[model samples]
Target: MKAAVLFETGKPLQVVDGVQIPELLQGQVLVDVHYSGLCHSQLAEVRGHRGEDRWVPHLLGHEAVGTVSAVGAGVSKVATGDKVVLGWIKGEGQDVPGARYPLVKDGKEYLLNSGGVTTFSEQTIASENRLVKLPDGMPDKLAVLLGCALPTGMGLVFNEAKLLPDALESQGKSIAVFGLGGVGLSALIAAYTTQPKVLIAIDVEAHKLELAKKLGATHTIDLSTENWQEALQAICPGGVDYSFEAGGKAETIEMAFEAVRDAGGQCIFASHPKEGEMIRLEPHAFHRGKSIRGSWGGGSQPDRDIPLFVELYKAGKLPNLELLLSHEYSLDEINQALDDLEARKITRALIKIAGE
Candidate 1:
């Protein structure tokens, strides 16, 4: 198998071929990866943003679409030849530890660490619970989004924000999505389904904000421009009913929290800032009924929510799934993909591991 090995933090991943797949432990499933989504989380890990790398020379990737080749004992969630969407979120099935692969380089043996699910390899060993069987006829590229971006973004709106359909239809209900990345755009697409009176998209990139408008943002604010917050306030008047921060920066998170209305507005941020950094907000804001919190993969349950998101996409509710994919790269070009992500040159990069 070919895999991108992260041998050290703050260094490019080494594309190593002829890597041996470890034996499947109990509750593990071997999968032939088809397509994997490159997320900012991986970038953080590679750049040493999350602190010391105890798991050096490990595999990194959380979302992908693959076909099950084999399953270990006690694995009932999937079978051989079944197509599945692999994710980091735990689902129904046995909870098992991650797999460790052994590889030899320059006549020396080294071990590679991996979580329950990783997609940076041509072949991967995923825990049974990390795999979700895909609906027949779903495209592998689109299914890849369900593993992370779609679920986390849509989940933030549907689950954490708890924005019911009726609530969205209510007159004067407004939403502000901070950072027009994959998750932010996904939140905008999902929030638009509710038909909120106001949908504001904020970002430093004009292209992303433009895309957000096409995806149903009623208003767009470029953070790079002066008085962008003033522009947002002019449109939203008394702040928004809800706000979502996906930029993974402390400043953006603080802005999202402050952009909510004083009473009954909610702010949710799925991005994790660098370790040792903190977000400071007005202490008196909480007393006014405004709330701010973090999200865990948008509080998604892979078995239940992934299917629902697919159904919605199938029904034309999510028209921008393909638009979210700005670029695609092969396993060997993984470093370039990460560079593009860090440069904000792409919304989401899809790593093609195998044929459709």
Candidate 2:
């Protein structure tokens, strides 16, 4: 099968021919990848920025939607020909929240499941337990996103921050989403469902801020200006009740804390760090009852959250297509997709592995 192979650090991806197909081992499944997304993690890997360039020879897909071609003898969650959405962190066994993935290497547990899916190839292998079956008729384009971006957004609000639907009306609190790309927009859409009292979004680009408004942000803050912090202060005078930093930068994560109300709000970090980079925190501010939490893949438990997003989208109540921005390229053109992602060109780029 064909796959994008990252040969070295700070370099473009080199396409390799006849990359061997991995096996359907214990708790694993083989998928004929239909669509794979270009996510930040893959870009970080291509640049060797994530310090995980070691998984180089492996495939480069994290968010993908495809059909089951076969499964290991013991698999039971899904069957051949079934449609599934592959999360970036695919692994075997039931991956309940708080379950420790045993694929820990060099001290850190590989946040992504070992035997689960990596979708960059024409065909891929995933742990059956890690894949989520979409209800029939969910468009492949939409299903592809639920695997990564959707959960990262929804899980942050509903899981990590625990934004209960019932709280929006009673609390009548405002929220801020500090990034307007894929994950940030996902946060906006999820926040829309709860109908927060006010939804403010921050982004360096004015166009994305405009897009955020269409996606449900009641207001937009342009962070490029010197007084952008004042803009943030203006809308959220008492500070927002909840803040999410989708940009994944230490500076933005720090800003979330600065934007939240005292003792009543929480800020969440949704982006993954490339290396061991650390973000500074205000210890004194945190002591005032403001909480900061680091979230992984939006704290998703696939079985429960995946279907929920799909069902909600199907009802036309959730914004799926609007939240996801997909630009498809063939397996050979994977480099172009990565380049576009690097340039911040595509919100969520998808690769057409096979079967249009």
Candidate 3:
């Protein structure tokens, strides 16, 4: 199999051929990955932003849509020939360690590291718990977002914020989202379904903010010049009912927290910045009914949420879903994809694997 190998931190991934696939363990499943999504997390790993380098020479990627070719012992969640979405979030099935692939690079042979789920390669060995059966009629490219971006982004709204339905309340709620990346946009789309009285999208780029407006954000704030908190307050007096942050920076997270109403307002952040960085919050804010918390994959349960997302997509709730896939690349151009992602050249990049 051909795969992109991260031989070292702070360096470009080496796309090597003739890599030997490892034997499946007790709960591993081999997948023929069709399309993989490039996320900011992968860029953090390659740039050493996550800190530490013990897992060098490992496979990197946690979201993709693929077809199962084989299953290991003790695996029952999926069977051979089953189409599935691979993700990092664990679900039903046995939990197992990641698979290591043996490959020869520059006259040197070594084992490549991977997690329970990885999608950077054309063929990957993923644990059964990381696999979610893909729903029928979903496009291959769009389904890839279900693995991470949708789950995490939409999860921020559905799971974390738990936004009330318009029918449940007399008036629509107000909300704001910091950052217009894939995850942020996902949250914005989900929040839109609630018919919020005010929905604001904040970002440094003009194009992303414009896309947000088209995706149902009632207002957009440019962080490059405007003060987000002041701009948000101007749109909706006082503050919003909820704030979701995915700016991948601590300052933005703090800004998200401060953009919400002090009474019963919630702030949830899903981005992971570099290690050693800390977010400082006001200690007395808890008394005011303001709350802040971190999200784990938007608190998603793949077995349940993935199917619901498919239904929502089919119902036209996610009408602008294709706009989120901002760029496309091949497996060989994986490094360039990462570079473009880091440079903010695209919203979310899709890497064509076996199905290309």
Candidate 4:
């Protein structure tokens, strides 16, 4: 198998071929990856934003679509030859440890670390719980999004914020989505279904803002310009009913919190800042019924929520879901894909690991 190995922090991944696949432990499933979605979380790790990288020379990738090639002993959630969506979220299956591979390069032995699931390789040994069987005929590319971006973004709106159908039709309800990445755009798509009178999209990139408008944003704000907050305030004088932060920056998280109305407003941030960075907020805001919270994969249950999301997408509720995928790359071009994501040149980059 060929895998992109992260041998060091702040360095490009080393694409190594002829890598040996480790034997599957109990409750593990071997998958032949077809398409893998490069997420911001992986970028954060590569950039050393998440603190010390103890697991160097490891595989990285959490969302992908693949076919089950084999299952280890005691595994029954998915069978061989089953097309499935692989995610980091834990589902109904036996809990097991991650896989570790021993590779020899230039006569030097190195260990590769990985969680129960990783998708940045032609083949991966994922825990049984990380695999979700896909519906028949589901596009492999689209199903990749269901692993993380769709689940997390849609989960924030449907589960975390608990925005009811009536609230969206209330006319007074307003929503502001900060950052136009895959997760942010997914939130916008989900929020748009509610039909809020005021839907604001904020981003530093003009192209992302333009795309947001076409995807049902009533207003768009470019953060690169000065006084963007003032413009946002003008649109929602009392502040928006809800605000979402997906930029993975502390400053953006603060802005999302401040964009909400002082009373009965909720702010949710799915992205996390680098270690040692903190988001400051007014202590008095809590008294006014304003609250802020972090989301873990939008509190998604892979077994339940993914199927629901598929139904919504098929029903035309999530219009332009494909728009979230901006670029495609081969397994060897993984570094360029990461660069494009960091440069804001693409929303979500899909890496074609193997033919579907």
Over the stretch 39-145, how does candidate 4's per-residue lDDT look in tens digits?
88999888888876898987899999999999999998999999999999898898788898888998898879998889999999999999889986458998999
Candidate 3 residue-wise lDDT, 1-356, digit = tens? 99998888999998989889878899999999999999999999988998867988889999999999999999999999999999999999999999989888779989999999999998999999999999897899999999999999999988887763344661388889998889999999899988888889999999999999899988999989887767887898888889999999998899888888887889999999788789988877778989999999999999999999999899888888999999999999999999988888899999999773
lDDT values for all models: 0.90, 0.74, 0.90, 0.90
Q: Measured by TM-score, how close is model 1 to the native structure? A: 0.98
Give candidate 1 regions above 4 Å deviation: 165-172
Error of 1 at 36 (Å): 0.5
Cα lDDT of model 2 by residue, 174-245, tens digit: 889987767888888888777788999888877777778778789888888646568877777868989988
- TM-scores for every predicted model: 0.98, 0.89, 0.97, 0.97
Instruction: Give every collision pair in model 2.
Output: 50-274, 90-116, 116-126, 116-127
Can you tell me which runs of candidate 3 are displaced by over 4 Å? 164-167
Query: Where does candidate 1 clash, by residue pair?
Result: none
Q: Of the candidates shown, which would achieve the greatest lDDT relative to the real structure?
A: 3
Instruction: Return whichever of 1 and 4 wins on TM-score.
Output: 1
TM-score of 4: 0.97
Q: Which residues of candidate 2, in runs, are more than 4 Å off?
A: 90-115, 165-171
